[model samples]
Structure formats: C-alpha cells, structure tokens
Target: MAQTIVCINNAGMIMQFWIEWVNDDGTQGWTQANSGDYPVDQRRSLDMDALNSQGESIPPGRLVRPHVQAVAGASIAGDRYITYTPGSGTAIYDVTGTSFNYSVTLIQS
Candidate 1:
C-alpha cells in the first residue's frame, strides 16, 4: 500500500513544505509536493513512496518525517520532524506561519 502526506497551508503567507526520511542505505532524503510556494488555503499531497534520494517507495514500517517552511523573501519560518509510519493511512497536516512564527499540525483521519 502507498502512504501519502497532505499539506494544507493555513498561514496568511505563502509557504512550502516537504517530507524527509532516512533511506534504506542510511542517507538523507526529501520530497516536496509542489513546485512553487503554496498560498493560503492551498493544499497539496505527496507520496511517501517517492521521498527517498532515489525516489523509490519506502519499505513498510519505515519511519518518515514531515517539514514545512516559508517562501522566499519571507521571514525564516519553518518546522519539522514529526515522526510517522508508512502503510498507516493518509496523513494530513495543517501548516500555519506568520513573520517568525510557524506551526505544523497532524490532522487525525
């Protein structure tokens, strides 16, 4: 089964988000759902399977991390590393940020 992470930008400003995971080979990996900044009320979905450096599906039971950051020309606002397991169901997260404040919420589904 494939796992997904959905990000809803609730912040008043534009933002960007991504997920990270340790590959089977012990290297760092990351993936972003959108090619550009997400505006308020925007939502995007990313597959956990393609989060690795090689863009391969993550093995079952592996741990994954989520991250959210601000867009260019904006104050440095970011948060990360909410641990998650693959094969569990879709993971929905809400991202909010302002000036220097940022937050991430894992919405139970």
Candidate 2:
C-alpha cells in the first residue's frame, strides 16, 4: 500500500474504503454487481465521472479528492491512498480475464 495522508491535512478521521477489482473477463458475474453497496465492507470507489476545477478529466491517477466517491449517503471525498479492499466472502473479481486488471476504491460510511 502507498503511504498516504488521510486527507489534505486531516488530523484524524475514521476513513475507510471499499474496493472493486475490475478484470477484463468479458463476462457477467458476481463481481460485476454493485459490491460497493455491501455495508459490511468499508467500501469506497473513485468517482470516475467527476470533473475538475477546469472541467478537465480527473481520474484516480490524477488524485481528485472531491471526486472520490462512496456509496449513497456517504460523507467523504478523496484523500491520499487508493486502497485495495473488496467486500468479503466472494472473490474480488467475478471473472478471470486474459487481460490486465483495474481497481476501484471508494469511501465507506
């Protein structure tokens, strides 16, 4: 994991995350579902559609705090670490792809 600051200058906050592993499996599976909705997991995902100050693209690689998204009713924005924690029981990815993998992390309530 990357050494991260909880927030831009957060002294302390119960920050948690839920993660999703998106594989290029090209098939529908449990992993394809909204696993982030699982309350048990400290679920969090990046708001891929979020815009920047200049309305420019701000993906995870760009570190968009305001764009860091969580499930509905969650009160959180982006911070520093992009975590890797998916809901339990089931595997992270539903299908196995012959291609690379992408991770989606979100905030937890």
Candidate 3:
C-alpha cells in the first residue's frame, strides 16, 4: 500500500482527501443502520502518492469509481480521517458517487 492525497473539483464544489487508515480490516459501514457504525480513535491526514495503488486523488473533470466517502458532521464540512487501533474486523465505508475528477499527490509518511 502507498500514501496518497486526492483533490476533487466539480462544478461548484472542491474537495481534498487524504486516506490515513487503509488497514485490511477497513470495510464499509452503515448510514441509518447500526450495522456500520464503528467508533474511530484518532484523526490524522496522510500524504498522497501516484504510484500507490492503495491511495486515491481526484480533481475537477475526472471520472472515478464508487468507494466509501469520508464525510464530516452537519456542522462540519469536507471529509476527515480518523486513526485507531486495528480492529478484529475491517472498517466499512459507504459507497457513493460513480464518477469524479481526481488530482493526486504523493508524499512520504
């Protein structure tokens, strides 16, 4: 796996994403269903990499596949990364959006 940063730009919205926890146990959690609510321990941001298959970055006018999106609470904006001890199982993420414009960044952890 590799460290990466993804920048997404659309019509009027722009997003910068960094994947901090990419453990084997990371899975897609739930929305209203309790089956997918897992508490995270800490919040941290990782760097971006292009050669890394485990990492993703997006920019405007790009197309991307649907994956678990990291979102903040209503009062907050954009996605956030959380870190915690490895769990007995993988952490699940929600699958949303099919296409995106992605710009990527690579950095050392």
Candidate 4:
C-alpha cells in the first residue's frame, strides 16, 4: 500500500507539516480539543501504515472512544484529531482512505 500523503500550505508558503491530537467525543476535557497551538505544524506525516499494512483495525477518522488521561487533568491519548495548517487559501489532500480527507482555511483574527 502507498503511504498516506498530505500537503499543507499557508499564504502560498508551505507551513511546516505536522499532526495534532484532539478529543474524539468533542468534549472539553482534552486540552488539545480547542486550546493550545491548534493545528500545530510540527513537520511530520500522520502515518497510518502501522495499522494499515498489517490489516489491523484502525479508526476511520476521529476515534469513537474518548481518550482518557486519568491523571491530574485527564486528556485524550493518540491522534484523536488531525488538522492542516492551511495558508490564506486552503490545504487539501487525500486520506489513506476516503473518510480522512479534510481541509481548513485560515481566517484573519
């Protein structure tokens, strides 16, 4: 299988690619959900081959079960959410599967 590919851009500049973890249930417990440096660009591809190649079951998009930290302020574990640090225009890409493709447009704040 081919490795999942992702392309990100920001104001016509390739804003470093990165992955972010989010709360699966859309709950507020997870800091990564709506806080922190959202859509963080850490320069890495969200690799799913580990579970894909071996035919192991993997969540399609967001995890169905909420990630729990169970310590201090609990939080979700794993990549529960994936985001693209889009340029002024937009970021687009195909997911390993059809269900994963997404895009985010930057709005001047």
CA shift at 103, candidate 3, in angstroms?
13
Per-candidate alpha-carbon RMSD to the true structure: 4.3, 16.4, 14.6, 13.5
Off by over 4 Å in 4: 1-5, 8-10, 27-45, 50-109
Report the Cα lDDT for candidate 1: 0.61
Q: Give model 3 RMSD, 1 decimal.
A: 14.6
TM-score of 2: 0.20
TM-score of model number 4: 0.25
Q: What value does the lDDT take at residue 20 in candidate 1?
A: 65
| Candidate 2, superposed: residue stretches over 4 Å from native | 1-36, 42-56, 59-61, 66-74, 81-109
- Per-residue CA lDDT of model 3 for 16-89, tens digit only, reads 23233333455432112111222233222323222232334222122111122333321112243333222212
The predicted structure with the larger lDDT, 1 or 2, is 1
Each model's backbone clash number: 0, 10, 28, 5
Compute the lDDT of residue 57 as modeled in candidate 2: 31
Question: Which clashing pairs does model 1 show?
Answer: none
Please report, in order, the local distance difference test score of every candidate based on alpha carbons: 0.61, 0.25, 0.26, 0.28
lDDT of 4 by residue, 1-74 (tens): 11232332222122223323235655422212211121223222334334334453333343222122212222
Q: Model 1: residues >4 Å from true position, as ranges?
A: 22-28, 32-35, 50-54, 73-88
Candidate 4 contains a number of clashing pairs equal to 5
Residue 44, candidate 4: C-alpha displacement in angstroms:
7.8
